[model samples]
Target chain A: MATGLKIKTAAELRTNYLRREMFPTIFCDGCGLGNVLNYTLWAIDEVGLDLDRTVFVSGIGCSSRLPGYINADGLHATHGRALAFASGIRAANPDLTVIVFTGDGDGAGIGGNHLLHTIRRNMDVTVILVNNFTYGMTGGQSAPTTPDGGFSSTTPYGNIEHPLDICELAKALGAPYVARWPVVSPAQPVKSIAEGIRKRGFALIEMLTPCPTAYGRRNGLKEIEQIWRWYREHTVLLDEWEWVEQFGSPEEREALRGKLKIGVFQDTERETFEDRWAALVAREKL
Target chain B: MHTIQIDEGWCKGCALCVIYCPTRALQVAARFSPRGVHPPELVRPERCNGCRLCELLCPDFAITVTEEGRVHA
Candidate 1:
């Protein structure tokens, strides 16, 4: 997958993609959300997407605030309903590219039903779901993706529930494009975002971002470096994970436990809802 | 020659660029910016290989690396 993406200087990216007045960003120091935004812009630039014809839709959350920073048409929708609003936009004007920015709480918890139906329907929209373990905006509450035994404001003792694997869920739902990447690495996420935009049907790119202020402060990762290094140490590439699972020794496999698998989970062609809708309209002459 | 620029007003003093710089060209500044955080300074400009990794990893969009004699504008 040769993205052929020309690396742009920070000044150029700021001039081209960002709404200058919006900065400095509201994100806390050491938060990985900014990295996510940077990678998305790179992907957009690589794809040569026309900002005029693109729509950035987001629900209420820290991650959802990303669209507000981009220099493009954006809809800051209600909590947990970014995909719903994005669906309306795509249906109204199929020509316009729709990209959604949603958080773990916004997309997988409050909007879990929306996430399911959207993937099942195979909507023509790209979703960037930022999973930072906890809900950073609402004062570090335990989100659906919070790791088991992870500490949060809501979970004073520890999160008893297992963390949700969003990429696996999207893959199971048969989304045409699904991938997950930690923000510690730059190139892979940028490439995956661009590929998701190019993919025809439902595309879900899950970003594992670090929330140093909310999540890290509560989870023993008090320092910025600790949290960033945590991500680097915790994530295992999907290919490597599979190899370890198949052939590694018991101790080696045990060491892999609790590590998140990051990579492209699914990429297969399928008939999108828009294509079916168009077919139905042509047939019924509606 | 490679040069790095730091936007003091925008930097949050995260030190990510300092920690991630491959060539050790950057260091946390002793002086504080108006923002009251110690923005990174190009302490060893000669060591910079112009990889632009700091530019890409900087969450604040506060760093820009440009090779001298080349116009990236």
Candidate 2:
């Protein structure tokens, strides 16, 4: 337990929440996704979310495989289209809550358009984009999110291109809620995911997880502990970065290295796409 | 009316089950079972809430609740 947890009985996370499997999960030892999923489910239960009315859309990749592991009503879509699938789900049933799960590459790369438009449209969707910095599912190819100078199959010479700050990108595109978290910090992640699950508008919870099999081995931090250490040291909570908010600009975003800032970049009471569409339909009498 | 069992072999005695039990019916006793697992004992049956908190918090998968003429917690 951290020094001051303010240990409350309820956990702000309902532990009884059930999903795809029983309590015992079969994820690999030290797998961060399981912790993230546990937090996600706890959030769902805390918010009293209707599982029947909630739909999860997953794209092709290790992170995308998460939806299938959950019992929630969800669909495993093709590569980089989880957002599109989630969009369709939200479009068809405005009342339902749609959540999209995508890996870093699938989301920030090919699914980039889907993500941009989803936020622009302010669709009622919660996107939990897991950024492990490498393509763990397919033999460790470099990802759009891999830190610059990080080694990957495609980046043996070190990645020349910069990694995208997803929360900033989402905020720029009009997402009502945007935040990032490290998977190891279980409690806050759970609270953050719950916040996303309860929000009525577009929300992004970017979890910076580690791919020990890919990222760790290539970086010479082969052990899971080293990766965990990296996650802890490199990623600073958004609140801590607020004082340094003056360091804002595309140039700074691209040049700044070493410290990976995490937190909710933006949250507003903007009207969601569902509201606008419903109003439009009401007016058009369609 | 109820049936519950904990796989003693897997219990790590995390005490999460004892902490999460809404009714506080389950408590870790000083005596360990034959398998050396500190099993949960129901000290008070009347206050059982049947919320399954014990089941949720058992990190070691070591507790199950079953009751007769009432729902298990």
Q: Tell me the whole-model lDDT of each prediction, alpha carbons only.
A: 0.92, 0.72
> Every model's DockQ, to 2 decimals?
0.79, 0.06
- Per candidate, the number of residue pairs that clash is 0, 2
Candidate 1 clashing pairs, residues 3+ apart or interchain: none
How far does residue A58 in candidate 1 sit from its true spot (Å)?
0.5
- Stretches > 4 Å off in candidate 2: A1-27, A244-256, B1-73
Distance from true position, residue A36, model 2, in Å?
0.9
For model 2, fnat equals 0.00
- Tens digits of per-residue lDDT for model 2 on A1-286? 1222232222223234334134344433344665566567666766768877788889988788666656668799988999888889888877888878888989988788888988888888889999988888888999888887999998899989988888888888878888898875666776777778777888999998877787888998776557767788787667656545665676555444578888777778789887898899999999
lDDT of 1 by residue, A111-194 (tens): 999999999999999999999988899899999999989999999999999888888899899999999999998899999999
